[model samples]
Target: MKCKDCQFCKYEGAGIAGGYKCKHPNIEESAKKYEQLKRKVINKDYPHIGYQMIKTSLRYCPYRIDREESL
Candidate 1:
């Protein structure tokens, strides 16, 4: 009875290397593939939708892009 697969690994392994440990080769490849995907911006073209809209979108997004709050 040996632990061949690391618990963190997505796949189950049956080899014994200190009781189920994650193999770096496969994990590294999988991680690299995951990182290859391009991140998509939620709003690419629109400058500012609205206060409520931006709030609905997310809190991190700046609420003042082209505003002149002097009045």
Candidate 2:
């Protein structure tokens, strides 16, 4: 997938193939948080709440896959 699809990536140009930067300062922290939130969804622990939280958290995750790619 292209870097533009990554949550941590910041696109500088006008298109998807443009230059970008990984905005996550702490990769480990970002990953940990992502995983924890993901588990909540998997375990069905307040799925509604977890889904909302995960939606926001995923946008800042360093390891998040491109939504386009996943489909």
Candidate 3:
């Protein structure tokens, strides 16, 4: 299922800057890596490659909990 349909997905921030983030405890490592890659892109450390890598790294969550089931 898509992350947007998962129970662990949480929306943070506000307005246009707001987005859904995975809150699954098991996603900590992946989240950290994502943050690091995000920083690199923001800091222009690996601008081109970072963006591509980030795109590839984003996949359907393995630990996703279906919202319907949880409810």
Candidate 4:
């Protein structure tokens, strides 16, 4: 799939791979806020931050040509 189709994609340089990288937040990092929130979750034993974050990150990519244009 093209960067435009992926939520984690960002338009930085030019061309495909040259200009793109996976920018999904969770892929990039677990921020202080997220870590704190994860600690507070009742089900601390379970892995709860992987899939959802990936999905969300992919869904909101900046370089996605198919992505909805902002007004």
TM-score of each: 0.22, 0.26, 0.38, 0.25
Candidate 4: stretches off by over 4 Å: 1-3, 14-18, 29-71
Q: Sum up the clashes in candidate 2.
A: 0
Error of 3 at 71 (Å): 28
Runs of candidate 2 exceeding 4 Å displacement = 1-24, 40-71
**Clash numbers, per candidate:** 9, 0, 0, 4
Task: Report, for every candidate in turn, its global Cα lDDT versus the true structure.
Answer: 0.27, 0.40, 0.42, 0.37
lDDT of residue 40 for candidate 4:
45
RMSD per prediction, one decimal?
Answer: 20.9, 13.8, 10.4, 11.5
Instruction: Rank by TM-score, highest first.
Output: 3, 2, 4, 1
lDDT of 1 by residue, 1-71 (tens): 11122233233334432222233334333333333433433342122223221213211212211121222
Clashes of 4: 4
1-71 per-residue lDDT for model 4 (tens digits): 44345555544544432434566544323333344534643332121223222334332233332234332
Q: Which residue pairs collide in model 2, if any?
A: none
lDDT of 2: 0.40
Candidate 1 TM-score, true structure as reference: 0.22
True-vs-predicted CA distance for residue 53, candidate 4, Å: 22
What's the TM for model 2? Answer: 0.26
lDDT tens digits, residues 1-71, model 2?
Answer: 23434455454444543344456566446445656665632332111122112223333244443342366
- Give lDDT: candidate 1, residue 56: 34
